[model samples]
Target: MWLPQPVHALPERLAQLIWGWALAWWRIVYLGAVVLVLVLSPSSYSRVGRHLLARRMYLDTLPILLGFTALAALLSLIITRIVVVTALSYGLSRYALEMVIRVLVLELIPLTAAMFVAMRCAIPSGAQLAQLRRSGRLVVLERTGADPVRMELLPRVVAAGFASVTLAALSCVVALAMAYFSVFGLGTAGLVSFTRMFGHVFSPEVTLVFVLKTVFFSLAIAVIPMTAGMYDLGASERRSELGGLARMFAVLLLIELVSLVGNYY
Candidate 1:
């Protein structure tokens, strides 16, 4: 069913705005679907939607992940050079690296990356989706005897999730390498301690929890945007954006709280 997707008056600024939204939608669906499968298996029929989502994600998310990783690496390095180094110069260097890694790399970096990615790409995606539905695209599909839910939206949700997870993993790898150089200055002396510290910080259970937390963060990022987009299909457009983000962020915070609790537990 092809719904009436009208051609709007696309002004340059609004067009740019719409483009951002479009990018967000694709990433949110692509990335979100992959991560969701990792979380739980839906019904067999959902697999087709997942494949579509995965395909979109494969085409779109990989390049974004690489770009984001590069950008994040640069940001982490700048922070380390200034904040971490300054602390060290003040004779507080002994505690600098671990603290930096904990705050900037492990905890803060991942959250920041997810949120930034969501806002940068997912929010716009959500809005466009809402507009698509409003334009009667969903109804059009129904008339054509097609499933709008699985065929149209599910793939998008999956893509958003996939983008988030892939980007996070890429950023983490960059952070790990940067952490070593930030502390040890490209020397081998820090590898032993770094490995030990890493091992201590991320044990079996801890590692599991960490992975879970990231997945939630990724899911929230995707789910919120998609929810917002879909909700708009049924509500007033003026205030319907980011419906999923609100719920997603709340859950993301809860997951963080849980992670902290378990870590200190």
Candidate 2:
């Protein structure tokens, strides 16, 4: 049976897609194992190591995160105003709060926070880690039983995750306030209605899902670049370090798409 060339290539394409997904899953599994080990090992939390590394990571990343948060606030305010105005025009004012909560807080803020950390913090840290590995410093540390993964990687991951959560929380708060002001102005006139609407929008289930999604986003931003960088540690060919970053963003987009489907559908 003769078939069109495109149709004949369909199965091969499907196979390639499936294979790519399988490799991604494998990488995810490997990352999960690394996280599990970090969690289960008490020494991964050595107070001095963790504290010093965490302080360095947070201090180094804070300025960037704050700058990103400011930009996010501007964009969020615009979006909130638009949503509020559009809803009022359509006689859907009652749904405005819920729409803002679900769209901005549940969806936009977390993803933005993750990408901000990934670009501004994680990629550079990964490149540094890769460079250290290439220079044989990591091997020396490992030989001395210094457990660089615990003393080094875990703290950065924890700090990056903390930064992501902090940024997301801050952005969400800013957006919520902006949404209220957009809808009801700065006066106390709408306080009661605003509180009621906020409570209704952030029901237990909605709150839980938002928290879970934020945690997943934070962890993804922290872990993906580190793992990707480590995976390519020994490659003979020196490609651009941004290759890991490109892969990290691809994974992030997939995560965001899944979150959207789960939230809306």
| TM-scores for the candidates | 0.74, 0.82
* Candidate 2 global lDDT: 0.75
Instruction: Write candidate 1's Cα lDDT for 203-252 as tens digits.
Output: 78877877887877877776667665564434434544543455567677
- Winner by TM-score: 2
Clash totals in order: 32, 0
Task: List the candidate 1 regions with Cα displacement exceeding 4 Å.
Answer: 1-51, 232-235, 242-244
- Lowest summed-lDDT stretch of 10 residues in model 2? 233-242
Candidate 1, position 166, lDDT: 77
TM-score of 2: 0.82
lDDT of 2 by residue, 35-127 (tens): 768767776667777686668576756787668778877887888788878999999988877788788888888898888887777767776
> Residue 85 in model 2: shift from native, Å?
2.4
Q: Model 1, clash count?
A: 32
What lDDT is reached at residue 137 by model 2?
80
